[model samples]
Target: MVGLYMVPPDNAVVLSVDEKTQMQALDRTQPLLPMRPGQIARRTHDYTRHGTASLYAAFDVATGKVLGSVTQQHRGADFVRFLEKIDRTLPRRRALHLVLDNSSTHKTPEVTAWLAAHPRFTLHFTPTSASWLNAVEGWFAQLERRAVRRGSFTSVSDLRSELRRFIAAHNKYAAKPFVWTQPADVILDSVARASRAMRINSAGH
Candidate 1:
């Protein structure tokens, strides 16, 4: 996994793909207080739930560009459509190396058939409960901090619009290749230790 980040194959594009599911379209009950000198912005405690959106996003590791879509459901069909969108965006000649999580939608027969047909595309799933390894997860964190969190959305359409605008701005100005600093051995050692501790605790129990 570390090697995939640090030293990807030549002529191949690495993409970190994932979904930010069930994002609420929340409308604040009261108007928010504007920020003033020596004071932070404040939002209303109460909110109305309009609906939810499922965001499927892909981050190009080489160019740091983001490609995303908002969907009502996170089914295998939805995932396949997202992958098709990605396929259309990328160059045909270059191989696609996608790093994603082991979600059920990802491994479904529909997704499998699509991958089989597109031989140039490859998938690498992150370890269970370790989605932090996928670079796209960091992008999701940024989206939450800068766009979603504390923002008021009266409906699902409003939320989707905000997300699209945020992604556009990010790709235009903030996009940059993510650098992997930790060595593979160091990461492996930490994982091993954590696994050992878990095993010991389980045995004790």
Candidate 2:
């Protein structure tokens, strides 16, 4: 993953893709307290659940810009639609190399068929339990912290609107290429040591 981020294919776009599933549209039970000079903002503990939304997002490694969609269902068909959106946005001449996790939706027959039809797209799956290797996860964390967390939404539509606004703001103000500073060998060595330790502990048990 580090190697791919550091040295991506020429004339190809590298994207880290993932989904933020089951995001609740929660409305606070009571009005939130406004922050003053000496007090911080506070919200009620209880909330009314309006509905849920699934966010399918793709982060371009070369440019911190993100392409995303909100869906009611997270089925393979929805994923295909997201991929199609990405396909339409990119230039036909440039290939798309996507780093993704081993999610069933990504590997479903529908998605695989679409990929087969679009030879310009290449899928690269990170190792199991290593989703952190995908740069998109970091972006997701930022989104949750900045946009979703501590937010009060009256309905699913409100939540979706806020998400879209956040993405647009990020693209306009904060978009920049993510650089991987850690060397590939250093990451590999650490993974190797952890694997050896796990094996030794298993043998002992």
Candidate 3:
């Protein structure tokens, strides 16, 4: 029942964790050139089909710092590895409140058993089908549009290196903390309006 505005103490850490799936590891032979005015750089329409990678990200709300990893698999072990990465990123003596989706791997008996031993940590899950509540979702969306989309890499390691570099650059200019707009009732009203419009269109059809 942790609320979105529940701020972390100065000595504690709050992390929003999420995993992005089916990320293609594409290879483009041509270098990405800058486009001139009224012109666009052209590249091959098709890309070499390399394998996919699972990217797990963790965002610290207080510090605006993000830690992430691109893994070959998205199993429970990989998820555990991401959690460990979060631990390494945060201050050691501090407590943590982790916000995440309720995936099977996240809530499995194995993960639960491990969590039981870590009393300093608390895991909170977003409601079903509402993972947008996790701030890391927005972080991944930014990473996707800015770096991952339509980009090329020579190898898996090359892609990882590029991601690491991009992350470092992003951290250099991290913006203000995210501000949630619109009150709950206003959001619900918007949804209701959309639903009414949909009903009207359906009746006409």
Model 3 lDDT tens row, 1-205: 2344344566777778888887777897666667889986656656776777778877777667777787888888888777777767677799988888878989767677767877777888766545666888888888888778757976777777767777787777874465557676665565466557757777999
Model 1, 110-199: lDDT tens digits are 999999999998999876656678999989999997788878998999999999999999999999998877878887776576557757
Which candidate number maximizes lDDT?
Answer: 1
| lDDT of candidate 2 over 1-205, digit per residue (tens) | 5667888989999999999999889998887778889886787789999998889999998999999999999999999999999999999999999999889999999999999999999998876656777888988999888878778899999999988998999999998998766677887776566557757777999
Best by TM-score: 1
Off-target runs (Cα >4 Å) in candidate 2 are 34-41, 190-205
For candidate 1, the per-residue lDDT at 80 reads 94
Q: TM-score for model 1?
A: 0.89
Q: What is the C-alpha lDDT of each candidate?
A: 0.89, 0.88, 0.74
1 or 2, which is superior by TM-score?
1
**Model 3 lDDT vs. the true structure?**
0.74
